[model samples]
Target: MKKFKIGYRTIKTAVGACIALLIAEYFDLHYFSSAAILTILCIQPTKKKSLNAIYTRIVASLIGMLYAFLALELVGYNPIVLGIMLLVFIPTLVSFKFTDGFISSVVIIMHIYNEANFTVSLLLNELALMAIGFGTALAVNMYMGDLQKDLDQYLKNIEELYRSIFSEIVKYLRNGDTSWDGKEIIEAANLLNKAKSIAFKDVENHLTRKENQFYLYFDMREKQLEIIERVLPKITTLPVMVQQAELVADFMEELANNVHSGNTAKKFRSKLEEVKEEFATMPLPENHEKFLAMASLYQFIEEMDKYLVIKQTFRGIRR
Candidate 1:
């Protein structure tokens, strides 16, 4: 037999379903399958999402039972009464923002017709199933593995891409190097998107009032990359001004070194201001080509300043 590797969430969900079944059997509930079904439905990827699922399902189950009881007592059990009950309750659950519980509520309504009665014992049975299903899901999700390491790895990837991008720009500015085809920008954008998704999931794993710094960090990088994309094309047509290119290349190299450092944002901003001042003091470009080159250099400096400002919003220094 061949073996397959299974994900942690899949394993957790399977365990939760087994636990729910055992608990339902221990309680002598008539519907152990219902508990198992709820466990499967409630086993979400994040603790926060799981908790929300359990809450919504529990509330919807109660509402469903109430409708069942009222229908049995007033209209008496019939296909027409069940239809009316669904017609009334589905919209009610939707209005209360409990749409996620619609299918679970229908299951509860089905149980009433299955047993052909709405007695107190039946109510107790549904409650037991609910308790077993949701409790097992909560227990399984309590152990969220360390996400900080994964988030850090993602940041490191983004930083390396930043280094590549700036290095290419430096090559172009210095000797009009056209070897690089600006592919790094697209790669960095894709990485940033993936990092943001992972960070958002990490936020959902933790139940807290505090913001997820990893998510914020990626978001900041995304904004910086936008500025970089704008600056890349500006360098493509610049006249080779060796002295200016050397300065810009050196500045970019330094900026890449301190990409993940929070303490250096202020320093970088100061250095950029000095560069801008130097451009102001320089003599006017003698030709149209030289003028365009100077204009592109000035704009690049301004964009670098904006990039540093975005980085300043991140919470911590890179490890």
Candidate 2:
């Protein structure tokens, strides 16, 4: 059944056109044959290129017919004159890579004239051929059902990846390690890379189906992802500086631990005060106290990560 459906459409169209042509022959209806040919060949569901093909075929057919009519009028109904006209026009059509049906229609129009006279019957034949061809293709496409489900899924995945990267960054920062010490940076980079790969493949494979306008967002995100990745290595330096500050904070924590354990409180309090003052006075990136508040966030995250680490560790926390 699946195989039948798969091959049925093309065979059905050919048979339909065959029957029309045979009927025209039996009834001595030449115009019906032309229209049957036109219909079967002109209509197809090629999506992006369908309208373009139809317009070009229509134009080419008209040119060929017009030239034939002009030749017939100027030179009269001579066989030699018709032969010479075909020689001149056929190459002109072939030179431009027009479809077989388009060029054949011209030849057919040149030769498909009635034995009786110029009549409405001839025009109807050509028109009917085109209608059948076009209608058959459209029917086949509709029967195949929807092919756009993949496009929707692709868009959804892209949006989800974008939001996931942002949310993960927030979670990593909450650890107070601005240096991006954990898995956050790597995970974001990997996911972003996957996102780009998916987008590129989707666009490349289905440019006809994809929207050109939506591509702007894809390009923008790609560039931003590259910049963020480049900045990541620099963030590593920030953790080193924060780790130094964390050492003092760890010492203060230890002192508090010692004092709680009944060690001499006076010396411990004195040292704790000194360490706290030094930590508070740590120079900003720009060496300005006012700007200490403006210190690099990456550095602060690392410093805080270490501070929290020791605090947690002293209080018997695993991480």
| Runs of candidate 1 exceeding 4 Å displacement | 1-5, 317-319
Query: What would the per-residue lDDT of candidate 1 be over residues 83-192, giving only the tens digit for each residue?
Result: 88889998999899998988887787898888887888988888888888878888998877777888888888888989888888877877778889888788889988
Minimum summed lDDT over a 10-residue window in model 2 is located at: 310-319
- Measured against the true structure, the TM-scores of the candidates, in listed sequence, are 0.94, 0.42
Error of 2 at 180 (Å): 14
Which candidate gets the maximum TM-score versus the true structure? 1
Q: What is the lDDT, from 0 to 100, of the residue 244 in candidate 1?
A: 64
Residue-pair clashes per candidate: 0, 29
- The C-alpha lDDT values of all candidates are 0.82, 0.48
Indicate the residue-level lDDT of 170 in model 2. Answer: 40
Best by lDDT: 1
